[model samples]
Target: MLNIKNLQVGLEEEDKQILKGVDLNIGEGEVHAIMGPNGSGKSTMSYVLAGKGGYEVTGGTATLNEVDLLEMEPEERAAAGLFLAFQYPVEIPGVGNMTFLRTAVNAQRKARGEDDLSAGEFLKVVRAKAKALKIDADMLKRPVNVGFSGGEKKRNEILQMAMLEPKMCVLDETDSGLDVDAMKLVAEGVNALRDGKRSFLVITHYQRLLDHIKPDVVHIMADGKIIKSGGPELALEVENNGYADLLAEVA
Candidate 1:
């Protein structure tokens, strides 16, 4: 469902490139995990895919269902069914969670030329998803991520994913800072969203989260490129033996 070819990206003013000839493909109904150490450019890949600012696509192309994804704006990308769940969720002090979600959902809907959701209907659907994701109603009424625990923030991210129902989803270190219970909850949310028409690229450091949300393919990234790609066993190997062994082969 998604294709990234020889992707090279860097900051707007800097000559140094962060992503060097990166290539990846994610198909429908498949889950892919990307594991790497710090400064490996995994997050940069996510940001570039999502069309965030300050990053210039120096080379390569990314396509979604045969459409040029890199040509679209961030909001346009969302309308094209691309979702990225951030590793760090920013708290909006005054913006209520539900309000923010409604605006986002409606904006996407409007962009797609669909009718805006009524207040009652929007609440019903979002509430159902929140409940399934184990997110409380009061949390929805509160400001987005305001004073929320690490687990709560992660759950909120998953809840947004569930509500958005994107064609492609990227989870950037969703397992970070989460405890055992929160990790399970976050993984379950991902599992429940799994379907034949959707795809996911889950970026994580450890293999723990992969235990719950088993991926069809696992990739090891170093520097700016994906060096090794394999099955679920690859994640276990990384967990047990660490990336040192794999890095040697790739380097």
Candidate 2:
């Protein structure tokens, strides 16, 4: 479970605030879709939740279950079962995908006092998930996201999510730049992980992805605040009527 209250965030060295009094709560097994136009601070919320540096919490609090999330470091947050799938996954020129995943997996396991997987076991586990997601073995052996297509990058993120199996996932624009097939692959990966012990906060601009994921709740954010909350039907309404009426209502 995750809870945020009157949360305000801004650049650490600047006075400009990107998030203003944003509040949200997501519980286990629930898939919540956050739909908003560009510059609505949706991505900002994801970064802040993930404890990215340079984002200062000017007001309020965020917690995972009973733990104060804002007090932890980014790696600590990841170890605490929080995962953020970025809008644009960065490429690491020298880090092979398998190498990167092994390091991350082992680090989290170490933090939790769990035994790290042997290379053989890790390969077996991840290979199965990668096969399900249509990720070739060659991709896993190559540098992380380096020279990968947009679809490959998105699928790779899902692969990591599956391998990590976090309690909560924040998918920040995972649908962006994805082809229809890629979108379905990513959505399937997400749906396969959905269960009573997990939750997802899907931040996206369009409703197409929602068609596959079928979120339990839909939230419309504007001007750094969540101004409207609705069900799956609201996503269709936004697609038809656009955010103009919603913006007016929020105003």
lDDT of 1 by residue, 98-124 (tens): 999999999999998999999999999
Candidate 2: lDDT of 109? Answer: 94
- Each prediction's total of clashing residue pairs, residues at least 3 apart in sequence or on different chains, is 0, 0
Error at 183, model 2, angstroms: 0.5
Off by over 4 Å in 2: none
Whole-model alpha-carbon lDDT for candidate 2: 0.94
Residue pairs with backbone atoms closer than 3 Å in model 2 (clashes):
none
Candidate 2 structure, TM-score to reference: 0.98
Per-residue lDDT, model 1, residue 5, is 98
